[model samples]
Target chain A: MTDTTEAFRLVVVSAGVSDPSSTRMLADRLTSRVVAAAKERGRETTVTVVDLRELLPELPTALSSQLLGPRFQRAVDALSEADGVIAAAPVYKAGASGLFTSFFQVLDNDLLIGRPVALAATAGTARHALVVDEEMRSLFAYLRALPVPTSLFASTEDWADDALNGRLDRAAHELVLLMESGFARAVRNESWKRYQHTFGSDAGRELGIDTDTDLMRLAAGGSLVDSEDPFDPRTA
Target chain B: MQFGIMSVSDITRDPVSGYTPSEAERIDAIVKIAKHAEEVGLDVFAIGEHHNPPFFSSSPTTLLAHIAAITERLILTTSTTLITTNDPVRLAEEYAMLQHLSKGRMDLMLGRGNTAPVYPWFGQDIRQGLHLALENYNLLHRLWREDVVDWEGKFRTSLQGFTSTPRPLDDVPPFVWHGSIRTPEIAEQAAYYGNGYFANNIFWPKEHYRRLIDYYRKRFEHYGHGTGKQAIVGLGGQAFIAKSSQEAHAQFRPYFDEAPVYGNGPAMEDFEEMTPLSVGSPQEVIDKTLTFREAFGDYQRQLFLMDHAGLPLKTVLEQLDLLGEHVVPVLRKELEAKRDPEAPANPPSHADLVKAKYGDDEPRQPRPNANRGDNVTGGSPYQDSEAEVSAYPTL
Candidate 1:
């Protein structure tokens, strides 16, 4: 079932504001490490980088109206389609950048559910390093994405040290292992229905309703219940 | 197909004039606007139900009943009557009474009203919105169809032998349209009940609604209502039309830019390109509307939002003239030509529903059996047999 010929799609979303920002630098480093890890396992990797700054103008409108313009929609599509996510945000005001969080906020709640995501954050000092575990992890948890236990946080001082690279390597390896093992796809395939609420769903019908139920029968305009027998002779 | 306009009944400062109509003025204007809808040759005039400020249609039945009295031809309906907050018993009685007053010139679209705070105000929890909507509508359905209903549900108190009166005119409940913007469950609910599904086609792109309508059509057939193409579907549209495309844009731009709903969000051009909104000549409006058929297949109703965003009544009337005289007539012929011969050409009207229910016989006119102290113990609540009562109108 493992198709080594298929290219794994990795979407790197960087929320750094400046052109020479360290956040993008960290994101690029993580993507390369993950790509190399996949290559070692005989899996080709395709990377798409989404810079949050390009979409800042559209975020306000997207936030207010729940309508995403074409550019923002393309970025969202890339993230949703990715086999794995490399998310890096610059910490601001003791939290992730508003642009970083808002982008994910407006996405469909189910888009990222059960997908593997590697969390990374860049800040001015070591004190804000906890932003990765405290903020980004919780955000991905809410989205139901699988965040590997290895969360990477890079600060100004950490950049000068070799420890940042080791953390990146560990997180990248975890993401590659999860993506290669096909755990995300398996979970999604097997349990997607569990996450969704469909109309006239079994759960909904089971809530003190049945074929003899006047509303249920009347809703179908006096038709016989066919929910159970899909190949009913009448329709067939 | 039925073509009409639905208004949110928002009162806002007219961007061009810097004037806002008083609640009294706005209310009067809406009545005049509805009457004009008939004068210009439209089929339905539906109004939104809102229980908060900036919106004046707190009581849609009162306004719709008034519109019914003035307009002889137009069908009075709601863009949506709140199915989540309002009591099903009250909905059953109030709408039934409205049906009698209008002489069966009415139907209603039900929705779980979108405002969050409104839930608690009506003693409902927003978290339980879907459950409340499902349970309440189930009860409302029974209240209209059954003479006396004994029911228990999660959202509301239990009912035993409860009878909602002014029993639906001619023993036929008003045709129901379940309106939803994006909820597939609502579409499924609509399909499950064999009711009409109305897609509020404003704000969002066509693809968003296409999926919902497609799911509804499939489920409509799956539930044995009709073929997918024959399922009842209605779409909400927005248009600002003028003699020329340029003038339409020039005139509507101010309102489009600053209007409350999507104002300052997407530019008018982008919005028009994306959604069903049209701001152009009558031909442009027609061209855009025809594409809806291409997207959602043949639908039964097309309602436009013509009166919101502080556009004065006069401008709305002018837009209606374009819609009635230029846009709708052409659409009616074009859509008819394209419709499948077997598919229903119009939504079920009061006359059609009564005829379907009673055939050539007289429709039911319930005469309550002389104040039985308890309807539960009585063998039959009405003086006449069910069949006899149903035959009274014909006699």
Candidate 2:
């Protein structure tokens, strides 16, 4: 912002269950460092948390019918306006929690186009450390979100490792640069039409109708052909 | 606004009785349901088209024509005629023949069928459904309006001066309603032609339908049809009514729990909360139906899904009695009282269309010219028709 007082929105979606879970703690560390990095660049930042545990009751209806309950709508609303997103999830088996993947899967594919995201995960052992980069990053990539290169995966031992702090700082620096540059906002404002979107998409803040499409012309009873084929096999 | 009933023609096992009606029995029962709807004072009867088993209406015109013979005033229509799979030429001819048989007591709603496999069965790819719907309807529009159609499109075989007969009754085509859940292109097509737009708001929440309906109304005005409120609109509602709220719930619980599409998913109560499903006494149905007008404004038609989920003939008839006697009468008066005086009274019926096309004059009864062994390519196809300059160049 020109005044340097407006806060860049940072939404943290953590699927950690327990009160003081490591997954959220990992996301929190990333969020704080991002805020600090942005502040160093003379930009303000504000963070909003989306706890997937609170969204448990709404998941069944959403998974079955694609009906967004109130809590899910709020999450979509926050993410739509987010300048950057820190998505953290717990590794249950060899994969990310279904809750985390489902929350992203059900979102309108255009909702996070070009959005800066920091992917992180927590598990009991370092054996499942690749969950963030290998699995969760693919999900955000499908949504067209821009994930920072360094994925944060903290196991029980990595929580105490000083190297975890270095990786978090690098991700934060990359996210702050992406947000400060306004890459997501600029792409959305300038080239949103290039993306595929449906009418009632969650990213339906734009109700702009392009009357220039061939479909619109056809809707107005215009023909799809520019010139009739010289050879009519039906007649000849 | 006009009120009616629509059926998916589902053949489900009666969750209470553990019995499923045979295909012949279900087909015959559908005709009886249409007659009873008319007997009870409902204004319209529409049936869906399904190409699969357990849903019997593959030929809607055949069924609607039969219903039209038994009932005098009940408007015969389709909840949705597949616009994507069926050739627009056949649609134009068959629907025209039905219109003449029913003597202008019919109209049809068009949709891209949801069953994906059914698309391939008809030699069409579901991936091209939207384009098929838009392109096919464009050809169909001309088939009914022009005496001879010289057309070509990507999806279907090209036509060289093809005549879809017997040219629409009184030279006026049957009114069309484009039914869609979320496609704005379908709504735009409906608006461009000033046709009625119908949304089945029974399964999902009203908010989803509201956006598309609002878009239709806005584009309806943009296309120079009329004011947004004056644009013809239709909605779908579902209900199971009885003498009291508890009895309504008790009777419908088994069907709601075992029915396809919605069963084993959201609880009936949650569905009722989010959608246009009303399960209660007559007053409760009326009250819930009233809120639809509040959400979507004064519109033309309301059709309820009454005879599905294997409620049996006897119970469905009883539900219709409550609906016709108890629910619809109150809804009619309340919606009428609340409707803007300038809004349309009902969707354009055949007579309304004839009057609009030829006001205060005799409607043209098209007569084929005596062309020697030629159908459509001879100068003009009808005694009173002009040869189109270039049907494929009309943009």
Candidate 3:
């Protein structure tokens, strides 16, 4: 009963610093909105959190050495394959933390290229709220990331105010919509194209069923293509 | 040459515009500064950690994680990853996870933190800070370098047979830089292990650092990590650059006055009197920094602090524009020309981790499924725990 084309994977990357952390709160809000929007659109979603605060302590050694062990390799594989990503952090000293910056230094540039990213930050006050747009967004641009237009900024004031919280809620909703649109575009274009090519080339020949009833039986038998146009012309 | 910038947060007013930005503004300013650093072709950007009032960056790793999503080439590092108070177990797991999230662009500076109150807050004693750093880092080092560590120490519970999950990319842990302002022990530690020794020369004079750097260099040579200069070295700086020297000074004075550390403390006078805090044109900053070579010898990494003191985002951005467009280019050309062929190639970069992981054909065979579950490796610079045991047992 599972829909083959209905699931979307979403990742929320929160720095997870313990005190006065608006970043985590914003990440939760964004995830909630993204999940809600996906639900409204009848798409199932899975959210994974990369909590930096929790994960940073256990990073391995010899990061710059030629002798890479097994554990670090697996982490790289996950990031390169992550679907939709949401990165949230606490603003510090005008830029990302050294720990946060160092984490980015180890990644391959191509992995994040064209990934849809939603950036958010939390701070004690609102003076540098645009840092997400200025510093973080700029970094994404360099990475060739497809960053969503709306970045959420939560200061102490915003967290305290009902009106500001409402604004953040709206922003989160929009962010998820953007993420879904990006995901859909990727699926409709890339995944659909691949699916079409497979069916178009080998559909009838591989199934070994000539008649329509046979084709239906084969399809029911889980050996044949079932789409309206298995050999999709849109991709062709 | 990996260049980075770390800000010591101090809420202050902008000298030129007279805008007094809050702590939040200071954080944003640094982010903009970091972005500009990346745009200008700098390889890394780092931030400091401080937990008291007037200093905003209590959580450096979280901020770096956010930045990880932003830049492609700019590696993120901590100016200081407190080694004394922070539990090694948490440090290992969190950084490993971040390595996965960022793909590989991460490293950190291990330090015995300066704050005293933080010791008790984390249920540690300030007096035992050095002992904690030594023991914790040793355990941490093993946790990253070994597959399954059988570790025992005085500070934390020992691990008989522990394997940190989510191993780093290509199984390479992050390059560590031990940052010390005054501690000779830290420098000795960095030298003993062939790790980078970062003499954050922000507050002290050239002479003050010479002794430390010399000690590190001598010890590094003694440990057979090649010649003294080849021993991994890095330094911190502070600067305010504009088109004209007068403009830079005029625009930065008020901000300096309001900087909490430099605002009311002796640090400002000492900085002006002895240390290098360039409030001038880019060339002046360059000249001041070049002088550090004489004192500390040719170091590997050089970082700057340009966005502190609540400078407005606009000013910080402009400074970065100058740094990228003008300052760094000249410095790179000049520095490269002066380099000796034997100088160890600019310390291993972040991109190397990925190349090691996927590039190697020999180790690509899929690991056994059951063993994979037990070892769950990651691609971060830090090590994982003996298992995926939560470092925050309290959590």
Best by DockQ: 2
lDDT of 2 by residue, B5-105 (tens): 99998999999999999999998899999999999999999999999988999999999999898889999999999999999999999999999999999
Ranking, DockQ, top scorer first? 2, 1, 3
Q: Which has the better lDDT: candidate 1, or candidate 3? A: 1
Q: What is candidate 3's TM-score for chain A? A: 0.66
Which 10 consecutive residues of model 3 chain B have the lowest summed lDDT? B378-387
Output the TM-score of candidate 3.
0.56
Winner by TM-score: 2
Candidate 2's clash total is: 0
Q: Candidate 3, residue B395: CA error in Å?
A: 40
Residue pairs that clash (backbone atoms under 3 angstroms), model 2: none
Candidate 2 is graded, for docking, as: acceptable
Arrange candidates by TM-score, descending.
2, 1, 3
Give every collision pair in model 1. A219-B193, B362-B394, B364-B390
iRMSD per prediction, in order: 11.0, 4.6, 30.9
Better of 1 and 2 by TM-score: 2
lDDT of 2 at A136: 91
> Which tens-of-lDDT digit does each residue in A1-236 have in candidate 1?
44658999999999999989899999999999999999998888999999999998778678877767877878877876788998999999999999999998987777777789999999988999789998899999988889988998988898988988999999999999988877667766677666653332221121212235433443443322324333232344
